[model samples]
Target: MISLTPLKMLVLLFSCVLSGALGGYYAASFSPVPAQIAIVDVQALVKKAVEKNQAQTEDDAKALMTKVKSSTEELIQRGVVILDAQSVLTAPEEAYVNIE
Candidate 1:
């Protein structure tokens, strides 16, 4: 028959704790490597996006201004108006249509 003395139990516990800590250290040392990261120039990417947006906005604004100018010129060519039945009757057909 075997009996465990307090001293033997303490030694066993200490050995278990020491071996567990050592095993954990070794496991961490051989852990899987991290995935590769793709490098990007964030400043350049932002600048390009901003420039593209500005160019698109400018193009849209120019087209709108051109359309507005042509419409205004057409209105001017039609003739000036004072509140009268003749002005209403003679107004351009385009003036009556609902523009999108």
Candidate 2:
């Protein structure tokens, strides 16, 4: 077995520590970012759409629901937490975004 000098041992230890630190940094960089909280005024959106089209048919309602569902799903997939405007008593202005 080869005997390791003190200097050699120190260098090896330093390399190991450096590699571990770099690996951890890279891992952290690649990790997904935390989700953001967003507020959506579902009632307002529906109201606006309904107002635009005075004659609301069943098909139109179904289409609107489908659009909302798909949009919510997309936001959820991107790690966003959506809160209904009515449900949230208070939220930061920055948290509010147009879902349309």
Candidate 3:
């Protein structure tokens, strides 16, 4: 059976812990990484935003088309509200009827 004396074992353990701590400190203090920096192209982003706005303006064209359709429906509903006062004519007393 082989055995190390108690005092020699303690000294070896202390030296190993001390060297490991010093190596970690030296590595952290002298790292060679570059610092962070940033740059942005403000004008190009603004131009892209203007283009997006121009594309979005086409929504107004669709809104106007819908408005025209809604107004046509309102006119048809108003025509239905008017009643026939005179009847027994060729078609109606006042309503315009196509003869053909």
lDDT of each: 0.52, 0.83, 0.49
Which candidate achieves the best lDDT against the true structure? 2
Q: Tens digits of per-residue lDDT for model 3 on 18-91?
A: 99999998998898743221122233433555576766455655654454445445445644332222332333
Candidates 1 and 3 compared: the better one by lDDT is: 1
C-alpha-based local distance difference test score of model 2 = 0.83
Off by over 4 Å in 1: 33-40, 47-51, 54-100
lDDT (Cα) of model 3: 0.49
Residue 98, candidate 2: C-alpha displacement in angstroms? 1.6
For residue 4, model 3's alpha carbon misses the true position, in angstroms, by 2.0
Q: Lowest-scoring 10 consecutive residues by lDDT in candidate 3? A: 34-43
Worst window of 10 by summed lDDT in candidate 1: 34-43
* TM-score-sorted candidate list, best first: 2, 1, 3
Which residue pairs in model 2 clash with each other?
none
